[model samples]
Target chain A: MDALTDAELTILGLLVEHPRHGYELEHVIEERGVRNWTALGFSSIYYVLDKLAKRGLIEAIGPRTSAKSRVPFAATEAGREQCAAATREALAEPSPVRARVLVAMANSAALPDDEVAAGLAERRAALRG
Target chain B: MDALTDAELTILGLLVEHPRHGYELEHVIEERGVRNWTALGFSSIYYVLDKLAKRGLIEAIGPRTSAKSRVPFAATEAGREQCAAATREALAEPSPVRARVLVAMANSAALPDDEVAAGLAERRAALRG
Candidate 1:
C-alpha cells in the first residue's frame, strides 16, 4: 500500500494520545498551529477521520457528548504498528526539499543577480520572522 | 493556474541556467546530488520535461547533437515570469515539515517511552551521519 499521507499520520498520532472527537482534534490542530505545515483544514477534519476509519487505522471507541456529539476514535493495533513504522520512516528519511524557491536558487544564475539576492533576502526575513 | 509542481519548477530552474537536453540535465542533477532532496529520478526526467514543455514553462530551443541527439529546452518570457512568482511563493512560504516522524513525535506519548527515545536516537544518528 502507498504510505500514509501526512494527514493520516498526524490524525492517527493525535488519536494515539487519547480518543478525541472531530471537534477536539480540529481544536488541537489549530491551537497548536499544526495547520502551518499541514494542508488539513477545519472542513477536512471529518473527511479525514472518515478516511482513517475506513482504512481500519482508527476505530470508533465511543461517542463524545457535551455541547456537540461526535464519535471518538483510537488507534488499532495495526495502526499503532503502522504509526511506529511511519514515524521511523519519516524521522530517518531525507526527503528532498522540494521547494520552488530552492529550485530558483539553484538556477539563480539565470536570473538577474539583484533579483536573486533580493528574493533570498526576502526569504531570510520571512524565516526570521 | 495552479502553482507549478516541484518537478516542473526544478526542471524549469535548470533550464534557466542554460538550454540543455535530456542527458545533460540528467548529468547535472546527478553530479550535484540533487536527487537527495528531490523526487526526480532518471526515468522520469523525460516525462517531467514533457510536462514542463506542455505548460509552456519551457520550450524547445533547438536540438542538441552530441554523442546522442536530443531536444534542448529553455525558459520562455512567460516561464521566467512564472518562475519568479513561484520562486517568491516558495521562498517566503513556511511550509510545515510534514514528516510522519513529526506526527509520531507529537503522539509519542501513546508509544512506549523507551521506543520513542530509541527511535529519536536512531534519527539523530542518521542526521549526524
Candidate 2:
C-alpha cells in the first residue's frame, strides 16, 4: 500500500482509537493538539475521511448515503493493518526536525544583531501569550 | 513580496553568507546538515536560483548566459532586505514541531506493544550509529 500522508495517518489513527463522526474527530484533534503538529485543518476532516474510505481503509458504520458528518466512521481491518505498519515505519525512521527558526538562526547574519534580538523577543512574547 | 519557502530561504541565506557556485552550496549544505531540516534536493538548487534571480532577489555575478553551475551568485540589495524581513518573520512566528513520531506514539494502540517497542529500539540503534 502507498504511504499515507501525515494528515491521513493522523485521522486514521484517531479512527482506530474509536469510531467517530467527523465533528468528533475535529474535537479530538483540537483536544489532542494535533493541529500544532499536523496540518489537518478543521475544514479538511471530511476530505481526509473520504480519501480513507475510498482507499478501503475505513468505512462508515452508519448508512453510507446518510449525512456524511453525522455518520460514524471506523477503521477497516485493512486500515488497522496499514495504520500499524505506518506507525511502525514512522517510529523506526524518524523524520528530521524542520523548524524554520533553525534556518532563520543559521542565517541571522543576514539581519542586524539588534533586529535578530528583537525578533527573538517577539517570539518569546508570543510564546508566553 | 511573497514569503520564501523553507528551501528557498535556506539557499538564499547560504548565498547571503558568501557568494558561491552551485557545487559549493551543495558542499555547504552537506556540511551543515541542511538536508535534515529542508527538502532541498541536489537537482533543485538551480531551479531555486532561477526563481531568486527572476524575482530580482539575487543575481549571477558572471555572465547570465554562462554555464549555470559554475557561475557565482550573490544576493542583491533587495535580496538582502527581503531575506532580513523573511528572517525576522521566521524568528518571530516560530512554527510548531511537526514530528511524526509524536503522532505515531499517540496512535500506538493501532499496533501491538511489542512492535512499537521494537520499532523504537530500531530507531535507537539507528541514532547510535
Candidate 3:
C-alpha cells in the first residue's frame, strides 16, 4: 500500500487516542493546534477518513447518538501497522526546512530593499508571536 | 498572488543560485536531499514553474543549448515577494509531527504483542539509522 499522507497519519493517531466521530476529530485537531502545520479543513478530514477506512486501517465502530447522531471510527490492525510505519518515517526524516524562506533569501535581489527588510521584520515578529 | 508551493519555492531558490534549465533543476533537487520531505518529480517541477510564471513570481530568462536546448528559469520581483512570504510562513509554523506513529501506539491493542514490540523495535532502528 502507498504510504499515508501526513493528514492521514494525524487522523489515524487521533482515532487511536479514542474512537471519535468526524466532528469530534476536527475539534481535537484544532484544540491541539495541528492547523499550524497545514490547515485541516472538514473536507480534508472526511477525505482521509474515507481513504483510511478503504485501506482497512480504520473502521467505523457504530453510529452513536451525540447531540447529533454521528459515526465514530476506531483503528484496525492494518491501520496500526500503517501508522507505526508512518511514524517511524516521520521521526526518522530530518525535519524539512521548508524551501519558501530559502528561495526568498536567495532571490532577495528581486525585492525593493525596504520591502525586503520589512518582510524579514514581519517574519521575525511572526516567529516570536 | 497565492504563496508559492514548496516545490515552486525550491525551484525559485535553485534559479536564484544560478540560472538552470528544468533538467538541471531536477538534478540539483535530487542531489540536495530535498526529496526527503516530499517527492519532486519532473512533472511537478514543470507544473510549479508554469504556475510561478503565471503569478509573475518566476520567468523564463532564455533558452540555452545543452545536449538539447532547454528553457532556463529565473525568479522575478513578484516571485521573490511570494517566496519570502512562503518562507516566513514555513519557518514560523512548528513542524508537524506526522500522526502515523501516535495512531499506531494508541491502537497497539489491535496488533499481536510481538508485532507491536517488533514495530517499536523497527522504529528505533530506523531512527538510529
Candidate 4:
C-alpha cells in the first residue's frame, strides 16, 4: 500500500486524539489553522477514515449524538502502528518535496521580482500578527 | 478558488523547468527521488495539468512524438505568478504544520518506546550516508 498522504496522516492524528465525526474533524482542522492552504473537505475526511479502516488502522465506533448523523471513529492497533511508522519516516528525513511552497521555491526566480516581494511582505504581515 | 494542492504545484514547477510530455514528466519525478512515499501516477499529473490550464496557470502545447501519444505543457504568465506566490508563502512562514513528522512528534509518546528509538536510529543511519 502507498504511504499515507500528509492529509491522511493529519486526519489520523486528529482521530487518535479523540473519536470524532466528520464535521467535528473538519471543525478541529480549521480551528487549528491546519487549512490555511488546503481546504480539506468533509468528504476527504471520511475517505481517509474509510481507507484507514480498510488498512486495519482504524475502526468505526457508535455514532455520535449530534444535530446531524455522525459516525465516530477510533484508532485500532494497526492504526497506531501506521501513525508511528509515518511519524518516524516524516522526521527521519527531509520531508518529500511534495510541498507546493518548496516546489515554488525551486523556481522562484522565474516569478516577477515585484510579485515575489509583495507576496513575501504579505506573508510577513500574516506571520507577525 | 482554493489554493492548489502541493501535488498541483509540483506538477507546475516541473513544467516550468521544461515543457515535458506526461511520460517524460513522470520519469523525471521518479528519477528525482520525488516519489519515495507518494507514488504519483500519470493520471494525477494530467489531472493537475488540466486544472492548472483551467486556472490559466499552464497551457498545453502540441503533442510530443513518442511511443505513446503525449501532450506537452508550458507555463503561462499566470502560472508564473502563482508559482511565485507559492514560493514566497512557503519561505516566509514556518511552513504548514501539515508535515506528518511534526504531527507525529506532537504525539510521539503514544508510540512504543522501542519503535520510536528504532525509527530514529534508522533515520540517523539514512541521513548519515
Docking class of 3: incorrect
Q: Which has the greatest DockQ?
A: 2
DockQ of each two-chain model: 0.27, 0.43, 0.18, 0.36
lDDT of 1 by residue, A27-126 (tens): 8998988865555766567777887888888988774453332677888888888887787666656454443455556656666777767777877888
Better of 1 and 3 by TM-score: 1
- Per-residue CA lDDT of model 3 for A14-104, tens digit only, reads 7766788888888877786775554356666887888899989999888545432278889997776677666655543444433345544
Between the candidate structures 1 and 2, which one is better when assessed by TM-score? 2
Kindly report the fnat of each predicted structure, to 2 decimals.
0.38, 0.75, 0.12, 0.38
Docking class for candidate 1: acceptable
DockQ of 1: 0.27
Q: Give me the candidate number with maximum lDDT.
A: 2
Selected candidate, larger DockQ, 1 vs 2: 2
Q: Which stretches of candidate 2 lie over 4 Å from their true place?
A: A102-117, A125-129, B1-35, B38-89
Model 2, span B5-88: residue lDDT tens: 777899999988889889889999999899887757788798899999999989999876867788999999888888888899
Tell me, by TM-score, which candidate is best: 4
Could you give the candidate ranking by DockQ, starting with the highest? 2, 4, 1, 3
Number of backbone clashes in candidate 3: 4
Q: Per-residue CA lDDT of candidate 4, range B1-129, in tens?
A: 667666777777788777877788888888976654333555677767778889988887874453332778888877877776676666565554344456556556667788677777776788787
Specify the poorest-scoring 10-residue window by lDDT in model 1 chain A. A94-103
Q: Report, for every candidate in turn, its global Cα lDDT versus the true structure.
A: 0.72, 0.86, 0.66, 0.69
lDDT of 2 at A129: 90
